[model samples]
Target: MTYLYPQIIFSKLFGACLLASLMLLAPLTAQAEYGDVVLNNRAEQSGMRPVIFPHWFHRIRFKCKVCHTEVGFEMRAGANDILMADIIDGKLCGKCHNNKIAWGPQNCHLCHSGLPGLKTGIRGGDSTGGPGKW
Candidate 1:
């Protein structure tokens, strides 16, 4: 039993080391898989979490034109310079996010989903589908 004790201790220590290595690398893997969008342009500056746009969810419902063309949303993140006033005045997201169509802008967290309290695993699609295309 004395000889077995040393082997058991070594095995336990090796398992712990392996676990620590995996833990350190876990975040990097997640970032690669979820490198969808992290719109932090004005979010952190304005003392808010960056908007994590979920292109996957939106594309599933509305065609790209509904936003990129009609709504005039830029393909890149933070390019629009969206402001709270614009939304309230029915300019940017307010166009559709109004209570009648979708959730109202009053629901701040809906669009300002960059809030730290939330976990945004949302991903977006590339420029594949467009008007008269798909």
Candidate 2:
């Protein structure tokens, strides 16, 4: 007969519970459409409305690695130095928004529709103090 230690059994149970919790929370995180990121680095300076990039909307079509790795967008909010000239020259946003893969910058209001001086960062917040609000 073989005997298992109590600590070993506890660890195995803990690991299983953690994995299950993550699986259950995955869908909730995906439902957060309000997690928009405000890119006001140059919008206000350039006389345009700030860009309200919905992180959730983009996540549905592409994975994080697509933009954060292959497309070269910094993972941190407001970290990438995205410029209109660079984008128009086929860099940063222009990688896909070049009127081919996706809509081009011609429709400025489509992206640059955030309020003035909105600052660069996430828009959603845990106002209710609930778990996983944002």
Residue-wise lDDT of candidate 2 within 14-117, one digit each (tens)? 99898778666655554324668889988999999999899888899989899888899987788888888898898888898999988997889999988787
TM-score, one value per model: 0.58, 0.68
- Those runs of model 1 whose alpha carbons end farther than 4 Å from true positions after fitting are 1-28, 31-35, 115-134
Compose the digit string of candidate 1's lDDT tens values, residues 1-134. Answer: 35568789999999989877865654444532233555665666777766776666677789989999998888755567777788788987888888878888777665566646543233333322222112
The candidate maximizing lDDT is 2
Q: What is the lDDT of residue 76 in candidate 2?
A: 77
Cα lDDT listed for each candidate:
0.65, 0.80
Q: lDDT score, residue 27, model 2?
A: 54
lDDT of 1: 0.65
Worst 10 residues of 2 by lDDT: 125-134
